[model samples]
Target: MVETGNRYMDNVSKLISWGHWFSFINILFALVIATRYLVAADWPPSLLGQGYMLVSWLGHFSFLGFAFYLLLIFPISFLVPNEKAMRLIAVFIATVGTTTLLLDTQSFTLFNFHLNPLVWNYLFGGEGPQATNLLFIAIPFIFLLQLTASGLIWRNLKTLHQKKLGPVIATSLFVAFLLTHTIHIWADASYYRPITMQKANFPLSYPMTAKTFLIRHGWMQQNEQEKSNRHTHPGREIKYPLRAIEVNQPQPKMNVLLVMIDALRADMLNPTNMPALSQFAGSASTFNHHFSGSNHARLGIFTTFYGLPSQYWPDISDAYTPPILMTQLQQAGYQFGLFSGQGFLQPEHMQTSFNSIEQLNMAEPISPVYDGDTQAVKQWQQWLNQQNNNGAPWFSYLYLNTPTGMEVPPEFDGPHQPTSTMLQAQQAGPESLIKGLFNDYQNAVLFTDQQLNRVFTTLAQLSALENTIVIVTSAHGQEFDDTGNNNWGHQSNYAWAQTQVPLVIHWPGKTPIQVDKDTSHLDIVPTLMQGLFETTTASRYYTSGLNLFGPLKRDFILLGDEENYVVYQADRITEFTPKGNAYVLDRNYHELENAEPDIQVLMKVLNELRRFYPNN
Candidate 1:
């Protein structure tokens, strides 16, 4: 019995040695397959970046292949001690793994993103087999290759073990892995573009960052305020506009004033809630069915100015490229007076939208919400006077933050009763709390309308209302537990309560008519470019929007920030998260478990996301 036990131990040791050799060969296979990712990625410009990319490519896949062996095949080798059984199991595992890698590479190349369970279901579920038949065809060949490799490695196991190069190769790979991570840490801290930009190039790659760690350990010191003030610039090249803009300036260039109210819901604009604004809308071109490009403030504003989807915000912001509209206005000799109740530093609009403007006002009054709103309006009035004296076509942007803060002056009377403070509402029961919170929101909107009245009164008094083109809209709509899933605020979903905002445009010499068709903030820039400047350039050249006055209607719209977005069709919304998870929901935000994404809409969305890049 003791002899038999000793023999079993000897067999286990030999199987482990054979497993190591098998894993080494598979690592080589994985490395060769992973080259597809490098090809799909934007190549690093620096020599050091190129070297790091190669080293990381070699090390990452080698580590993954070895890890797979240890976790799945190493234990199986002992359970089934026979060499033939081990080879069959290893081949099957390897084939499945290799096939998955191949599928991921294809998905990444086409979509500029990787695959997850949702994407996998889309690829192999339902009619997906028809779309991915070619990839499936390669599976049998992969199995045969893995099988042949397993057999060769098994037959030559003793010879490979005798050579004893395993330790050298393993050490080299481990060193490469460590060196890549160390380089990423330094690159991230120093804001080194070449290496830092490659962070998302590799699938399942999350490089280390040491900014907070270094600060905590006293190795680095950075001013918190200055860091917050700094804007993010793009790490890669992007061709915004795709080409130079050509436009014929209108004979009598109208002064444009765009007023954006924070968290203003479309439904709240009525005789009861916002009397002054409701009256203003009656004489302007009011869009009853309108949506902001995103539920988030930054992206919503970005979309309005750039006339592009929110996904491009990061690239545009990072590149410090002002929108085509702003540049055109500048070239037409329009003076700019930009004011935000909430300072532009947080979203860093000073670095993005108003980047080209000289002597920009980045300061907002440090006071109560009511005082801030009052001051912003006063500043705009003063600026308008100065512009009128200069006799140049002027463009003014006034952003109010009253409704978002849900605060009003104590002296002011609110029509909405039984309203609780935001904190009080938060502490109340969920069902009862929403009503009170919503009441508070209504009162805030009422106060914001009063400020709007002041602007209108000033324009009329100066007789500028006839020549000035005024646009009243919101950056994004607010939410108050409208989804019933305990979603209390914006950025939670792309539901109507968060995306639908009031859009009332007072274009000079144009008929004031209510537009009931689907429209978006994205249409704003394109409208100004065509209607005001008479630009003959096609809308597709610089924007993903149609002219607001155009007869063509959009069949669908997109809403979200950089990491997550939803494609809103007529009856359904397909939401996608950063992790590649997707959910098909009805118009009411209820998930439809059996529903599939509309392929046509998704294809259009994918095209828009990639078209603005340097190379298609």
Candidate 2:
């Protein structure tokens, strides 16, 4: 009787052990699938995800300290393979992870997943069952898997302990996964790399969002008072909208919203390269004679923001300039917000004017550079809704950095590559490859344009479309296959590719005025004023840039490395690429041969930049 009773107890223990072991195995397997789907959705790219990594990294280091403490307690290289022990670890992980999911709901700013459910408020936010239902099913299944795995571990404890170190190895792996976020906080790297890169919005939004949140919650009260005060003609204190101030007219404020597509060039504005984008642009004012400011992103940013002339601030860093566009809008009773793809706090280019700047960084801390910007946009809209009662018009800037910032050329994953694909078409030669690269650029451009369609759609849905003025322009065109110096992107000038770009303006409820002459980003700030205020045209009154609504002073646009110190300009008929200090001064950029007058103007702009940026 004693022997039979012991046998029954032993069998019961084995079954319980198997149940826990299988449960764990199932959970671990489920983890792999969760990671896979997250990757497939390209989740990080749309989240504007960044800061999660820095926090995660800090968590990893903490775990490491805990692991060493555990080593001291056990002294045996492994924990005893008791099913109870494995079950304890499994329960620990699932409990912490699920609790995190529940606690994720807070102020919208804190809702990174946007799955916050305000069960208490009828009008609070949450849509469809996407993230919520996913977690709902995932958590239970994960628990079941963990339970089974724990049971399996129990049945073979004694012999398995003699041979294998699976528990230690598994724990170590979990620790390693924890540490990856540290790298994310500091730099850009993905664990499942080459798979997708856009990291979280650490450097991009940490301080910016914190600051904006405080300000949004009335911390800006001190600054808000400054906004209400205006200086007089002699810098005397005056009330805003002074009664004695001269008035041309009281015009309806057209809430202008500008979307600057960074690193975008013109040639890609088409059907084959960018079909969806092409369709979007077809409805707006398209200008054939648009050129970018300076070479690329940094330089282009300064010119468009301040209209200080690319001659003054080249990279928007380490140099000082006068008041800029965003500030001017604030002076005129407008609220300015920016949503960008570049790290908002680094590289110095983005540190300039704005009331608030959203994430505009990455999807996760360890994700790629061009990934998270779009999520910043979604957050921007949510924020707008919350602040709708602020009683002032708003100017929001959404700058996308995709297709343009990919480390490699664009990729098309539908129906495979068509017969005319760049790969097949450019097999001819290096020049052909260059052409293919150009083709790639255009395809990315199209991708960018298609995304804008979403932006417009969202704006219209919110009743914010007609009350806004939208301007679309690129920072600079890119040089491919070293047509200039074997370089493959936006930092230099080559022909018809780098300096020349496209520009468009679509004012809500206003007529689209097309121009035949030429315009560059320098004209942006002033032209923006043109759209809002009916008085002083951008170029004629306060700014040096020629107004699109006024006379055209430039026929051929200027191009330079720093400032076109050594000048180059092509006439309407010339066709030759210039060496050394180069410029395209001819008509349609056919090429120019030693044109003197145009070259002189180029030299003047160069000298002007030097005068302003003397210390730089």
Candidate 3:
């Protein structure tokens, strides 16, 4: 029995040796095939970027080959211990892997996106089979090549082992892999565009980020890290507007006052929670079915100013390009007064929306967001009074965050009963705690509403209400486990509770009509461009949105952050992740088994996302 066990162990060892040699050969093959990806992607302009590209390519594919060997061949070596059966299985696995890689490369080359279930269904579902048949023909050739290589590696395993080059090759690959991650960490911390921009070039490549680690060790400061994350590469170029904006100056230039409340949910605007804002909405052109461009303040505000999807954020922010809306406002001689409860440095709005404004007020005050809200309101009121005296049409942006912080002053009693503090609710479990937290959110909203009413009263006192275009809306909606899935905050999902917000537009001459049509924060820019500036430029040139007051109809709403987005239809939501994978969920965000999105709508969405780029 001992002799038999020794023989079996020897066989397994030999098979393991053969597997390494096989993996090495396949790694070469994979490297050759992966060149397709390099050819398809935008080559880096810098020498460092090119060096990173080469090393990452070598390390990534080497890792994949060894991973496959460990996962598939290593187990089989012990189980089967038969060279011929192992060779056949190995060949089959290699063939399938290679074929999948080939298909992904092709997909990436054509679409600039990798293969996912949604893309697979779209590529092979209907008439796609006929178009893709030519690509499928290469699978047999791949299988034959893998089979021949597997047999050759097995036959020469002893000679390869005697050569003893495996250790040297393995060490080189390990070094290359380690170097790749190290360079990525440095590049991410430094915000090196040439290196950082290639983050999504390879599929499933999640390179290491050292911002937090460096900050912990005192290698980097918190403010420096925030700037690094938000700073866009100035080297990159984009065609924003696609053409120059032509504005026919209005007869009487209208002042625009855009009031954005943080974490103000649509449901919180009722008579009970926010009586002041609800009463204001009754007189203004209120939108019942309105959505923010994103579930977070940063991108939501970006979409409002840029009139574009969040996908363009990186490119636009990288260039430090102000939105066309802001540029138009500046050119039209609109004086700017921007105030935010939360500092703009964190989101780097000063680098994007307010990039062109000289000496902009980025924030009012920092701690206890309630105090910041009060200061912001006071500052805006003072600015509005000054603007009333000046003849120039002024633009004032007041961003309040008291509701987002869930804070209220001690003097003002919260009418909502059974309310728990944010800390109390967070420490407790998620059953009835969500209800108490929600009541707390209502109290916060009520406090914010009172602040907003102060602005309206000031406007009425100065008689600026007749000439100012006062638009009240939230940056994004706050969530409170409305779906009962423990989703208690924004940026978690694209559900109604997180995306929906109230839009009350008090246009000077427009009738006070309640609009039930679907609208977005994106529409704000286009509406202002058409109404105030009287710009003849078509909305499509710079915006993905239509005029909110002009024949508003939408088949779907596109809402998301930088990496992932959801195409929200009336019945179902199709969420696309960073990897391009699609998840079909019902209205309440419950996963719907075997459901797919409308292909036409997805096609339109893809176009909308890519249209702003220089070459689409």
Better of 2 and 3 by lDDT: 3
The whole-model lDDT of each prediction reads 0.81, 0.48, 0.82
Report the poorest 10 consecutive residues by lDDT, candidate 2: 230-239
Candidate 1 error regions (>4 Å): 1-6, 44-50, 124-131, 185-200, 209-212, 221-233, 250-252, 421-433
User: In angstroms, how far off is 42's CA in candidate 3?
Assistant: 4.9
- TM-score per candidate, chains pooled: 0.92, 0.50, 0.86
Residue 603 in candidate 1 has what lDDT?
55
State the number of backbone clashes in model 2: 52
User: For every model in order, what is the number of clashing pairs?
Assistant: 2, 52, 1
Error of 1 at 191 (Å): 5.5
Q: RMSD to the native, candidate 3?
A: 4.3
Per-residue lDDT value at 358 in model 1: 82
Best by TM-score, which number? 1
Residues 384-424 of candidate 3: C-alpha lDDT, one tens digit per residue: 88888878988888889998878789887998756776547
Model 1 C-alpha lDDT per residue in residues 301-370, reported as the tens digit of each score:
9999999999888667766889999888887878888887666765437657878888676675446877
Order of candidates by lDDT, top first? Answer: 3, 1, 2
- Predictions: Cα RMSD each: 3.3, 24.2, 4.3
